[model samples]
Target: MGFLLVLGPLVTLHELGHYLVGRWCGVRADAFSIGFGKELFGITDKRGTRWKISALPLGGYVQFAGDMNPASQPSEEWLALPEQERAKTFQAQPLWQRALIVAAGPVTNLLIAIGILAAFNFAYGKLNIPPVIALVQEDSAAAKAGLDIGDRVIAVNGDPIESFDELRDIVVPNPGTDVDLTVEREGAQKEYSFTIPTLVEQDRFGNEFQVGRLGVGSSPGEIIAVGPVEAITLAFKQTGDIMVMMVQGVWQIITGRRPVDELGGPIKIAKYSGEQLSLGWRQFVSFAALISINLAFINLLPIPALDGGHLAFYAAEALRRKPASARSQEWAFRLGIAFVLSLMVFVTVNDVISLPIFGS
Candidate 1:
């Protein structure tokens, strides 16, 4: 129920982008349906738009006026009409307007992410931690090197350490290698060189690896309240950071640098949603935000049967002063559908194999 509640809102917001933008462009929207298949309920609005709730709750659609067939084709009947009446048809609109309508879905998802992130930052303030030392493990590398608790680490290997995250980045990879640390203890500055011990640990992605273990923790810093403007600014930065990470992951996969075991599908997502739901609302919301971003990015890829594919076709038409041949367009759409279906099957199989159901 919670997952549906979360996913429904995001999906609705995405489709609403198409509906609203189509209406603004004077392209009549015949049916604004949430979900698919059998209609559970529907009503005509003042503008003669049929707002409907369908049986399938996964996603929805906006049917434009003069969509030739129930399958959403270009209507010859509408095209044969007088020029003035045909102006409201989707194909009749300028290419730029059509492109905008197509692009709006993914843009809405990004905007939704930014809004959610800003709200989260505003409510929670921000988690702040300093690079100051709190505890040094006994008989550890620090202890063997004459480093003690209460020593404030100012730099690592001559690089200024501003946050614990930065310090961890320096320490985690170079296991058993000595790193010079400049510290301030008892108001006196001193440099200590120590090597981090090697220990096997599992990462969040379920990959196990050996990494340096310092057996030290940082001191907590004061939480600072951010103004609305700062919060929004940081939110955008965070969003961009996440997008970068996602793109890198895709690149790694494509280059065979990352294992395919990390790939997941709808089953994995549903399992994750259920697991996160047990943890708390905030955790689930974070998961949803991440998934929403992924959806937006994937939909924008220039593949057939996708918004990007349509926009690409529109671009070609604009440049050549004519649309692609109908036969070519049909074949392209069919190929795209096959590719997407095959991908879905592959990911679904992977998900099932990785789950307890398959006992793998």
Candidate 2:
């Protein structure tokens, strides 16, 4: 139920983005589904589109006219359609319109995340912490790096930091990394280089994780209320920052700097959703926002059978002044589907073994 609460509405909205945009572009939709597999039940709307829920509740799709399936591969039957019917087929639309329709799903997820974050900022204000060291742990990274009390951290690796949160964002994911820290002490600015120490920590659920720790403390941060415009602006920055962290994490995993087990699938999402729901509504909603951004990011990857893949094909079409051969597109989509299924299996296995019952 927790998983459904978090994912269902987001998935619905994602498909709705495609459905609405396709309609606006004069493309007819054959079906709107909340999931894949056998249809549990459905209702045909006045416009002749069947809206239904399916057996699988993990994801959803909108099947536009001329689409052979939810992935939006063009149907061979479309070419044989009458002139009037062909006019309403998705494949008959201009390249720009086709691109827009395919892109809408992921873009909507991004907008939802931005709106949720902006609303939180407007309601509860934002954290404002200056990057000044109040204490340095004995024999710790900061101490070994010659950092002392009252040292104001001015930058990390030449990037100016305004708050302690920003400093942590840059440092935490980079365990065992040598970083250049610029600080102001006694009105003099100097730089210090040190390797951030790796620390193993556990959450309330006893899930172990590793993070880089500088072993420095800061004063309690104040919260400043933001105006409506500022709230939205800050939300955008926060979203971008999260995206950067995600990229860094993926890179670390690829480079063997992070564990492969860190990658998760549906089971992990369900577990996380339940855990966050237990914490509080705010935490759960915030998790949803994070997932929304993640969904958008994943869909935009240039893999065949995804929104990004469709867009990639459109780009190719634009460059070559014609669509790719139907045979080529068919093979690419088949390969994409196979790759996605294999990844799902791997992550599901990973999720199961990592459970407490499995002694991870």
Candidate 3:
């Protein structure tokens, strides 16, 4: 139920983005579906678009006119339609229009996340903590880096640090990376260079993850109210920060700095959804916001059989002043589908192996 509750609305909103934009561009949609596989039930609207629920509840899509399938690959059948019908088909629309329709789904997901985060910022204010070190763990990264209690962190690398969070933002995503820390100690400014250490930790459910830790503590921070504009701005900043962490995490995995088994799929998502839901509404909604952003990021990858893939093709079309050859596009789509399926299988196996029952 938790998984469904979190993902259902997010997936629906994502497809709604494409459907509404397609309609606005004068392109007809054949179907709008939540989930995949055989339709469980549905109704065709006056415009002939079937709105339905499907058996698989993992993801959803908007099948536009001229689509060969829900991924929106062009269909040969549409080319044989009457002139008026062809004009209303997605494939026949202007390139810019088609691009807008395809891009809307992921863009909508991003907007939803920003909206949720902005609302939270406006409601609860922002945490403000000084960058003064109150405690440094013995023999930890901070101690080894020559950090002492009462030292005031002035900057990370070269960027000025005003709060503890800013300092952490730089360190956390960069585990094992050397950095120069500028601090004010007594009456002098000192610079220290050292590598941030990686700490392996587990949550209440014992799901393990690694993060960069400096092994320092600070006094409790205060929450200060922010105005609407500032709240929105801060929300965007927060979103960008999260995106950077995600990119770094991926890079770490690719570089072998992080283990491959850490890559999770649907099962991990379900586990997290349930865990967060049990915590409280606030935690659950925050998790939903994170997933929303993740959906947007994943869909925007420049891989075929995704919104990003279509956009990539459109970009190539824009450059060449024509679409790619039909045969090449078909083969590319086949390869993309295969890659996606293989990735799903690998991540599912990883998820199962990481489960408590499997001795993870």
- Encode model 1's per-residue lDDT on 1-360: one tens digit a residue: 655766788888888999889989998888988898999999998877899999977678888877664223466797687888678877778779989998999888888888888888888877677777788888777777777778788899898877776677667755666789898889998998777787768645453445677878777777778888988997887777677767766775677655565677777777777777777889888877877787778778888787778888888889999888877887888898789879888988888888765654
Candidate 2 overall lDDT versus native: 0.90
lDDT of 3 by residue, 1-360 (tens): 789989999999999999999999998989999999999999999999999999999999888878765445566676678989888888888889989998999999989999999999999999999999999999998898789999999988888999999988888777888889999999899999898898888889888888889999998999999999999999999998888888888899999999999898999999999999999999999999999999998899888898898899999999999888877887888888899999999999999998889877
Off by over 4 Å in 3: 69-75
Candidate 3 clashing pairs, residues 3+ apart or interchain: none
136: Cα error in model 1, Å? 9.7
- Candidate 2 stretches with Cα past 4 Å from truth are 69-75
Off by over 4 Å in 1: 68-75, 128-219, 317-322
Residue 165's lDDT in candidate 1? 63
Window of ten residues with lowest summed lDDT in model 1: 67-76
Distance from true location, Cα of 103 in model 2, Å: 1.2
